[model samples]
Target: MSFLELKNIHKSYHLGSQTFPVLKGINLAFDLGDFVSILGESGGGKSTLMNIIGGLDRNFDGSVTIKGKALNHKNEKALDTYRRETIGYIYQSYNLISHLTVLDNVLVSLDMTTLSKKARVLRAKELLARVGLAGQIKKYPNQLSGGQKQRVAIARALASDPKVIIADEPTGALDSENTKEVLRLLNEIASEGRLVITVTHSEAVANAGTRIVRLADGKIESDKRIRQAYDRQDKEHLSSRPLRRLASIKTAFKHFRHNLGTNSLIIFGTAIGLFSVILFSGLGNGVSHYISSQITKVANPQVMSVSRYVKDSDDDNALSMSTDDTPALSTNQLDQLKKQKHVAKVEPTYSIPSATVSYQNQTVKMRYASNWTAASTADAIKIGHAPKKAGEVVIDQDAIAKKLDKEHYQDLIGKQIQLAYQTNKPSGETVTVSLTATISGIGHSDSKGAQVNAVNTETLQKAMQQAGLSTDPTEASVKVDTLDHVEEVASSIDKVKDGHNRLYKTSTIQSLIKQLQTYVNIATFVLSMVAAISLIVSALMIIVTMFMSVSKRTKEIGILRALGESKRDIRWLFIAESLITGVLSATVATVIAYLAQRGINGVLRNLADYTFVQITFRNVITAFFLAIMISLLAALLPARRAAKLNPIDALSAE
Candidate 1:
């Protein structure tokens, strides 16, 4: 039995219903240690026969039997395994992948095996050294001469330790000296007990082999043996070297580094996209914080203003000032509010309708006056102090400035002030009273609206009772334990159902804070979407770039296919390149965004009193992931194209 057999091989090409037969019923037998050359003229089907024997062309009608197993043309995996384990190819073009060094070109084959990284490198280096390319291993294919490139191709073929070495016009492009050198290497390879097959048109090249077969008009005309095939001695067992596998990461990195100028532009373009998203998001957060701080600065976050019910119309001053209709809060309601989560203290409040005040012959018709025990906790006071005794009062500086015909109303503090107001009792009777008290403090002018003097609730209530007015507090101020829980507590209070329609109306600076934040978020999302369009454009750029790369590396893809790489490997190689670019772009954008945030915040700090840009780590991670996903999706079409290319046609591509 022969080591390899081809039975009834037939191949042809078709052009618009015209049949052009290339090979006709060709049969051949091959054995280990045979250095056989197939010699023929142009169009004599020597190349077609070589392609069939090397497993590159499966369209032929034939049964290729190796070691008693026939090849299955339908099973791609089986064909790939056969090529990887049993056959090696040396192209006439010396198809060394241009991006790889001589050593890396050999290592490309070794990467398919299960050998360790160290073992693979050692074996690749050994193969290069054996081919007399030891010192030239670091050089690229373009840097080497024709002879040296051919030597590198030989070393790559030997790296996989295949039993069959197929050379298609291996010496076709070399000088006489280099051709002799390659021919001698082929004979040495055959002498190591492996089959060496070559296709050539030169009779002298065919004569160098142990056997010669001549093809004419698509059929073998003669087959003759010049001598017995060289047999290896016991001490010369070079074909038994173990196969070692290498990673493709190094290949991807090499490609990236080789085109740094182009790739750097891509990275920068992608980084700009990512930077915009981060910058806008950070700016939104900063603006939201600044607004929140400003709003809460005048009021207290932990202090919630509780009213019987909010007046639906700001013009309904009568409803607002009518204390008779004021809904009395029940003891049960106060207890419930105190028991609520995070509620620390609840203070009762009293109001007197239609109050009039006089100080030093300047009388003013004041709005409804209220006394909240928790008023001292608010930062609304601008001068003096909050009322601490029954007879002490805090006046609004703005209202006093108007009545006094002067600014700087702080002089009114520590002076006695007269107040008169009418209040309706539970008996439906109107009561009028007048009292005098010393002004204690002046509240800030920016306290939302025209404010009345604020006093202790107990002090005001006691005086009202003496005047025959109802003292059952009209409103209450609920103090939460922490500012963070103020909104939550307010929500729970609003949810408390009661028979009265005016159960509780909650208001705090938090409502304004949330409204501002909502606007910021909407603006940020819209801006980010606009920025993401640039990323989409960048993705399109990546697609175009990857397609261009695939076009340029078609021959390299063929070389890889010949080296036993699966289609999936080719796809992943391109995908990995995009992934690397994504990560690099993301890293650069994050750094730039962080620095931009610092610069903007620094400028804002000088202009205002707050930072205007704040970037979080979450933004960084999101930007990175978005960039990578976009890049990967963009490369899919190009990667698939590279993977599906025909190996034979790719090798023949210029």
Candidate 2:
């Protein structure tokens, strides 16, 4: 039996219900070490016949038997295996991957074999040396002359040690000197116990083969033996050579590196989106921390603030009424709060949002003031003493300096100041009260305002009653027995119900911190969402870039498939390229966010007590993962399109 046989092959092309027969009942046979050339005119079906024999075109009616077994054309994997292990095609155009070096082009074929990476490189170099291009192995195809490129193509064909070498006009584009050299190489290949088949229209090329076959109108017109075929005493069995997945990644990275300019822009665009998300999250955390710290300074953890929250009753329109008409915490409510678990003391206090104090014609507008108790006053006094008796008051030193001269401010510590504020009478009447009090001490100022003032609660209550104004406390300050029970006592106070089922709204240092944190989280989420919109643009950019890459690398895709890579391998190549871009972008974004955090903190160091932006590992990692996932999803369509391209069509692409 012949080593390779094509028995009665018939083929046709269909164009919209029109059948054009190309091959008409052709029979051919070849043994190992046979150098056969098929000569034909331009439209004599010679190319189609070569395609069928090389396992590239399967749409034919034929029995292709190799070693006495018929080829299963319907099995895709079987066809790929046959092409990989048994056939090496040398195209006339020398279709080499433009980005790969000459040696790398040869290794593309060997990547499918079981040879180790070092062994493959060694073999590729040897093949290049054999083709007289050893010194030019690192050069790209475009850097080589036509003759040299053809030599490189021949080296690539021989790299896999294929059983059959198919040269489709291998020297058609070469001059006389190069043509002679290429023909000698083909003959040498035939002498190496391999079947060499060359298809050409030149009669001189056909005469160089050991056997000559002529075709006319898709039919074999003549067959002549010019010389004896090499004898095959020992038969070699072909082994399976599957494509290596990592080889595609290496190839993809090579292509990406080759076009770094465009890919860099893509990576930068993606990094911007990731940087925004990471930086904003860190900023929110820092802002929340700053707010919580400020709150801690204002409210002691062992102290809880309780206020009456009047629910709408059916008997009254309380929502439409003024603050004076709204209910304040009555005496019974304060007594009840003081009786709760872990309650050490409850101080009924009256708060006024706007107040005025005057010392001898010098006046200052106080933004906040509240009737004070001994427990509240003891923590804030910086000089002199707190309000221990009926007519004493403590004021902020910063507020006093802003109003009076510095010399006068020091001498006014024992001087009397007139305090005035609006109040509500029991008969639903409004009145203004002006009371005189001695300045007993000074307190620290805050960011909100410098007007921190406190007067004795009992003295203020008596002054309100004498002025015919209701003196019921608007808010009560509950002092917990211990700092550990502050949260528990606050919760209990919040849940305390009256006969009308109304509970007091409670605020503690811990609760205030939580509320501020919640606000910060909401702001962060909103900012992150706004930043994430850029990722859509980034994803679109990735899609466009990947599609452009696929378009530009069409021929490369064809070369890989021709070298035994499956469609899945081609798809993975593009996906790997996209992932590489994503990871690089993520790294850049993380670095930028970290630097921004440091810069922001440095700029705000003197203004605030703590850092303003904190970039955590979680934010960095999340940003990176999101970037990669978006890029991978964006690349799916381009990858599938590349994988589905026909190798023959791709090879013919301009």
Candidate 3:
């Protein structure tokens, strides 16, 4: 058998639902050290034949046997190996990765090899020098002349020391001078006992080859001998490592290095969207976590709370009742409410909302006025014991807005503070008073009064009188005899008219969480949506980048097809590039967001006086998922467009 052989081969393509046969029963054979030239006109399928031979396109019919192994319908993986290990390709356009230096470009395909880094570098330099690029190894593709770039391509083809070098008009893009210089490199590669199969339209280059093969309508019509044959090595000297399958992550990185200026600008452009999405989501999460924690710390979950809604709240014109105009329940209404089915023990409480606290004449208006419940409710306080009598008041941790020299977060607990108050007379006259009360307790509110404490009589009376005009009022929680009956008692409390304003302990706390959640949820929605816009922008950025790559590498994509890189591979290449860009962009975005989130947390933490919730590592992981999903999704459409490109036109485009 000849060193390389092809039995009758056939190929066809589909256009708009119709099948057209292109390559009809063509046969050919060749051997090592043969500089074989094939001359053909445009549209004659010379490149297609070269692509099939190089195993880039594996859809052809019939046998193409090399060294007794048939290359028939092998899977893409196997063909990929065949192309990487057995065939080296040179194209009309050099197709050097634009961002990589000549030497580094030569090292890309060998990424998965076990060769030492130094050895790899040395090998690349040696090959580049052999191709007359010794001094140009560090120069980027654009920095070199057209001939220099083609020489680098030739050196790259030889770097892995493949058994066959397939050149499809390698000299086509060059002027006559550069074309001759590149041809001289091909002649040298062939002279070194390597098989050089070149498809060209140049008659001069064809004359220098040892044999010439002519094609008409895709079949070899003539085989002409021009030189004596010489023996050559058929076994590859390099590893059969696959380009993208094996750990070519390094290759992708190297490719990135070559394209840094272009890709960096692209990635930077995409980051705004990504950063926004993460930040909003993260901030929302932080707020949610904070509120949830605050609620849990302040209440018991198994206990249910009952609240009364304004019956016609949905009516936009519902009458607005003034806080003071809403008449307090009468003693008879209170009695009727107490007699309800689940009637539990109840307390009568009084609140003077306009009350202010005074410390040596300085006062801060209380957001929450004096709140009194049945002594039972006092047990819910976090710091002190339950209170039994009037004048002794339990304070909220932040009730005092005044700057105090206190130490702990809840330091106002045992400190002495006074309640100053005023009352509006029925005749529309306002009266203010100087009644003083000591802090008898400090606590959080919850049902059951678990944390509640008793207030001493002295403080209780002071609060009642200091608020300008409160006759002694009693406040209580209905301690229902049974757990299930508690809800009934809570509901009944809502129907009561107590001659004085009264609020059920359970309803107030529930309303607090609901109100707080509403406000927080709005923030979460706004901030997260703001962040999502960034991710959307990032996706668009990725698409733009992939589109640019497809545009710039049109010639390379065509050459890849000619060298047996399938339409699939061409598409995959674009996808791979997008994924790479995504991964890189994600990494960058992650770093930025991570630092930003932490910085926010750091500032907030120091403002611990202002911050209630603590942000943790969970934020990082949340942001990571956002980035990866956006990245992969962005590449899908661009990859499809790349796959649909016609190789003939892509290659022919300048």
Best-performing candidate as measured by TM-score: 2
Tell me which residue pairs clash in candidate 2: none
Whole-model Cα lDDT of every candidate shown, in order: 0.81, 0.83, 0.64
Cα lDDT over the full model 2? 0.83
571-619 per-residue lDDT for model 2 (tens digits): 9999999999999999999999999988889988877558889888888
| Model 2 quality (TM-score) | 0.84
Taking the tens digit of each residue's C-alpha lDDT, what string does model 3 give over 151-247? Answer: 8888878877777899988988888888778877887778777889999887888987889988888778899998886567444376744344333
- Against the hidden reference, what TM-scores do the models get? 0.81, 0.84, 0.68
The order of the candidates by TM-score, greatest first, is 2, 1, 3
Tens digits of per-residue lDDT for model 1, 1-654 = 988999999999999999999999999999999999999998899988987887778798988999878988667777777778788899889998887889888888877766667987999999888889889988999999999999998988888788889998999999999999999999999998899999999998999999999999999899999989977433432232222222565688789999999999999999999999989989998889887766565446777766566546343111123345657776777787788888889877666666888877888877756774653344666777778777888777777535754664767778888888875667878787667778887765332464646765666767777797655555667888887887798888876666656467777667767766998999999999999999998898899999999999999888877777778878888988988889999999999999999888888777676888878888899899998898899889999999999988888888
- Report the lDDT of model 3 for residue 420: 55
Which of the two, 2 or 3, has more lDDT? 2
C-alpha lDDT of residue 517 in model 2: 86
Candidates 1 and 2 compared: the better one by TM-score is 2
Q: What TM-score does model 3 achieve against the real structure?
A: 0.68
Query: For every candidate structure, what is the RMSD over all alpha carbons to the true structure, in angstroms?
Result: 5.7, 4.6, 8.1
